[model samples]
Target: MTPRPRKQVLLRLDPAVYDALARWAGEELRSANAQIEFLLRRALGEAGRLPGAAGPLPRRGRPPKNPGGDTPADE
Candidate 1:
């Protein structure tokens, strides 16, 4: 499956706000950018403003191969 594209945004925050966000993000074990996205999703969900179903989470790493796997004749 093709990967979805992410929109790049330029957000300007006050230094104090940025510092607070960085601290919070570290506490949550997420990058500052990821933390922002997480908070936005939560707020949107709480406000009943989320669009569409969350959908299946993207698979991690390589796709699993068939259990009855094929081996190359050379092997």
Candidate 2:
């Protein structure tokens, strides 16, 4: 599947708001940008404002070489 291109947005937040968002994002183990996107998606879903179905999210980070070949049982 072709990856969807993300839109670049410019957002302005108060200093305190930014700090709070950063802290919360850290706690959730997500970057501030990802945390913000997550929140926006949820809010849109709740408000019934979401666009047509989104494709499944692509897995983050590098894909494993040899797929499941790293397990001890396979060694």
Q: Cα miss at 67, model 2 (Å)?
A: 7.3
Q: Which numbered prediction scores highest in TM-score against the true structure?
A: 2
| Model 2 residue 28 CA deviation in Å | 0.5
Query: Looking at candidate 2, what is the lDDT of residue 72?
Result: 48
Clashes of each: 0, 0
Residue pairs of candidate 1 with colliding backbone atoms: none
By summed lDDT, which 10 consecutive residues of candidate 1 come out lowest? Answer: 53-62
lDDT of 2 by residue, 1-75 (tens): 556887799999999999999999899877888888888888888999978766544455577776647764557
lDDT of 1: 0.75
Which segments of model 1 are wrong by more than 4 Å? 53-75
- Cα-based lDDT at residue 32, candidate 2: 87
Best candidate, lDDT-wise? Answer: 2
Across residues 1-75, which tens digit of lDDT does each residue of candidate 1 receive? 555677699999999999999999898777788778878888888999977756433343456564345764456
